[model samples]
Target: MKICLVGSSGGHLTHLHLLEPFWGNKERFWVTFDKEDAKNILANERKYNCYFPTNRNVKNLIKNTYLAFKILKSEKPDIIISSGAAVAVPFFFVGKLLKIKTVYIEVFDRIDKPTLTGKLVYAVTDLFIVQWEEMRKVYPKAINLGGIF
Candidate 1:
């Protein structure tokens, strides 16, 4: 299956990277920031850099939404996955409209509340995964998969 792994830089990127076991053998690409960590981690992988400072940033959000349309239309990935900090919102929404499956793994640290990205994409996510059991209360449909860390 072709997978589009989308996330913000740093922790969110690390969270998705830890799932290499599942995506390693698949045809996959990434959508993330063009920061040092992302550049280093995905040096040899296919990656598309997205707009940043996405939290409460309307301009970046609009820019990313366009980027999402462009990338999703071209890549045509079968699935879109992320452990996010806002950047995944546009991708998930676009992917849903394009009939692509989406999986959002909530960050491992948030136990009591849902992250803004998680809450925004939950409705469109095909499979919502939570690292902590308590997060299930915040996201009733989330599947408790323990932790990816």
Candidate 2:
């Protein structure tokens, strides 16, 4: 299956990278920030840089939404996956409209509270995974997959 891996730089990126066991054999491309760490980690991988400072950045959100549409259309991945901060929002929403399956793994650190991106994508995510059982209380439909680390 073709996979579209999307996340921010740093820990979010590492979280997704840890899932290489699953994505490693699949045809995949990434959507993430064009940062030094991402550059180093994904040096040999196919990647598209997304607009960042995405926490509450409205302009970048709009830009990313457009980028999502463009990339999703062109790549047409079978699934979209993320361990996210904020960049996953536009891709999940647009992926929903395009009928692409989505999986959102709530960050390992947020034991009981939900990340803003998780809350936003929960309704549309096909599978919601949480590292901590406590997070299931916050995301009632989430499955506890234990920590990826």
Candidate 3:
């Protein structure tokens, strides 16, 4: 199966990195934020196009939407796995619209509440996972997968 790992830089990327072992035996793709620090990390690798302004910047949303479609159209991945933040929102939606399975790993830092993007993408996601088991009570659909990375 072709799994598309999407997330922001920092911790999101780290989480995805941990799950990299799972994809070593399967065809996989990655999509992390294109920040100055992350630019070279995912480069020269099999990762898809990266985005900028990793935060909830206004200007980047529209651009991200277009890029999302481009990635979805080109990659046509079978599934998407993401660690929450705003950037993953567009990518997750792309997978949803394309009828692709998606695994969402809630941010490790969000212990008591849901992140904005996490809440937004929950309904459409195929498998919602969390590091903390307590989150399962709030997000009844989520599975407790412990930590990714």
Candidate 2 residue spans exceeding 4 A from truth? none
Ranking by lDDT: 2, 1, 3
In model 3, the Cα lDDT at residue 25 comes to: 84
TM-scores for the candidates: 0.98, 0.99, 0.89
lDDT of 2 by residue, 89-119 (tens): 9999999999999999999889999989999
Ordering by TM-score? 2, 1, 3
Off by over 4 Å in 1: none
Could you say which candidate leads in TM-score? 2
TM-score of predicted model 3? 0.89
Q: List the residue pairs that clash in candidate 3.
A: none
Candidate 3 lDDT by residue in tens digits, 1-149: 88787877877787777775787688777777656545666665576555677566767877887888998889888888888678788887877887888888888887768989889899999999988988987799998888655
Flag clash pairs in model 2.
none
Higher-scoring candidate on lDDT, 1 or 2? 2
Tens digit of per-residue lDDT, candidate 1, span 24-47:
999999999999999999999999
In angstroms, the error of model 1 at 121 is 0.7
Model 2, TM vs. native: 0.99
